[model samples]
Target: MRDINVSTEAHILEAAFAVFSQNPGASLADVAKHAGVGRATLHRHFAGRDDLIVALTLTAAQELDEAVETATAHCQTYTHALEVALGAILPLAARHMFLATEPAINDPRVAEVYASQTRDLTHDIDMAKAEGAFDPHVPTEWIVQAYDNLIYAGWAMVAAGDATPKQAAALAWRTLTQGTGNDAPSARNPWHPH
Candidate 1:
């Protein structure tokens, strides 16, 4: 019985994310309709938009972490690993359209999630550096900041309706790689720097 209730709650939150992505300002009633749940039931669980949004953000963070995990699973090199991780996040971006609007939020959870992702990205930057994937001319901090900015820029472009999520993602890939990718793969391969 507890498991069933938990399942239903999870489904409702997924539905909430789907609805909120389409309508960032949607109310609980709106999410209830999307979740196919009564308003009372939705409130019994989520209670409010802030709760729902925080859950959605955390879901996204989990997805990103999983992406990194999968990417690093067979990873022999950091550059290849980061690329794989980015590939994993592609689907997340396509589905979680709410991320386009959430960066503008002043909520502490918003900042909290941002900081968490920053830490993860910095870890990747460090790995990439150790693997000799970064431009020697760039500071690791600058590379990390660029990666974070790229995420926001992709979301911003989607928010402005200048591009679709697919396009923003492609541009993000290009921007991040161009900004941080090693200028000469021959200069050094940390795995085999002779």
Candidate 2:
């Protein structure tokens, strides 16, 4: 079996995330600094932005899977599990608003990671649909569309104004449900669906 170590993988992602967060256009040199590795070392592990993005994307997928696993570990109802899993991603989604846009900041490789993250998100969207967390008639395509629309809308709100992170999360939640929150949420609750 392939040797998989969460700590090491997380380290790599942390480095990549920091760079992407700081400057979506961050160069490998930037990521190397964040990761505390040499350029050669970074290259040894990831050949380029495309490669690094793919690796980062895979890491994102795995961590999200783990988040769901963690949320679902207690053997509780699916709502409990879904909430836990969603919670993990909510924070990240709330925090990484910029990276979602302008993927070619320092490395166009970011697009790869972006794609990976969306794929994992699609999985959760499926789960939510299956469990009726979403409206029974909520099409998977609509969920995908909602994700794209809401992410940009939410991120713009956070970046443009003095909006707090809590406000950002709430905006994302409300918009995802209704895709119609031009302003911040009326209530600062992430779980309150439209």
Q: Mind giving the per-residue lDDT tens digits that candidate 1 earns over 1-194? A: 89988988888878877877677788889888888889889878875766777777777777777766976799877777766665565556545657656652466866777787778778878878878777765677888877666766766676667877667767877888775678746455454467
Candidate 2 on 47-101: residue-level lDDT in tens?
7877776666555556656665775688455434534444455445533554455
Candidate 2: where is the Cα deviation over 4 Å? 1-13, 72-85, 94-138, 151-166, 176-194
Tell me the lDDT of model 2 at 134.
63
TM-scores of the candidates in the order shown: 0.76, 0.57
Q: In model 2, how many backbone clashes occur?
A: 6
> Candidate 2: lDDT over CA atoms?
0.60
Model 2 pairs whose backbones collide: 24-105, 24-106, 25-105, 25-106, 26-106, 49-109
**Which runs in model 1 stand beyond 4 Å of their true positions?**
103-116, 154-170, 184-194
- The deviation in Å at residue 135 for candidate 1 is 2.1
lDDT of 1 at 178: 70
